[model samples]
Target: MLALEELAAKYIQKTERVLTLLKSVNVSVSPDEKKVYAVVDEAKRYLEDAKYYYEKKKFETSLVSVAYCEGLLDSLRMLGYVEFTW
Candidate 1:
């Protein structure tokens, strides 16, 4: 397993790419897709919290938060709520 320092370094290196990937994803939902939109909104909040933990040097928490964000994104993708190249 990677140590905290290595994990943090990797996170720093990959965060921008992940953020870009997230931003580049196109999410289109109609007014009736309120629940789906809410899930996306919660994922966005987790991403923000990940950034916060990363900035504070809470590497493990940041990793978990980012993982949660990604999990949410994956769920949306599987459910056809979002579209992306990756």
Candidate 2:
């Protein structure tokens, strides 16, 4: 098992990478499409949660939050709801 500090550091790096991906992606949400907007918004929230948990030394929760963010982003990409450069 990894030490708590090591695990937390790894999670912080992951969260940073996910945030970078989000920054790199170009996602446009239509003002009229509430459903798609909600989905993207939820993903953004998860990203924020990941950072928050990572700062608090909750590596497991941070990893889970980043995973959820990635899932939402992938679904949006698959549905053609958002456009981004991979």
Candidate 3:
């Protein structure tokens, strides 16, 4: 039972590690809605893949996951989902 709990805890912690986005990264986005829409699709796919890797307990792959989120966030900013604070 203790072992199971420990493993579960480790699993949760590892999954959470991939939750962060690299800070202060900036990219330009076009004001065009069509271009923003395309970016939204691409970014969503990447972030989803990243989450998939993170769930597999692959830390290296998790880093790639957050990279996807960062990409998506940039796209969202361009799409007007959020402002480009940077």
lDDT of 1: 0.68
lDDT of 1 by residue, 1-86 (tens): 99875675565446445546654334454344777668778877887787788788888988888777778777777767665443
* TM-score against native, each model: 0.67, 0.64, 0.47
Error of 2 at 75 (Å): 0.2
* Deviating ranges (above 4 Å) for candidate 2: 1-32
What would the per-residue lDDT of candidate 2 be over residues 1-86, giving only the tens digit for each residue? 99765765665566456545554233355445777778778887887887788788787887788778778877877766665544
lDDT of 1 at 62: 80
Error of 3 at 57 (Å): 1.3
Q: Clashes in model 2: which pairs?
A: none
- On residues 1-86, what C-alpha lDDT tens digit does candidate 3 reach at each position? 44533444444344334324323223344456565556655655666665566567665665665565566665565545445443
Higher-TM-score candidate among 1 and 3? 1
Q: Find the candidate with the highest TM-score and give its number.
A: 1
In candidate 1 the C-alpha lDDT for residue 10 amounts to 69
**Candidate 1 Cα deviation (angstroms), residue 47:** 0.6
lDDT of residue 36 for candidate 3: 57
Report the Cα RMSD per candidate.
3.5, 4.3, 8.6
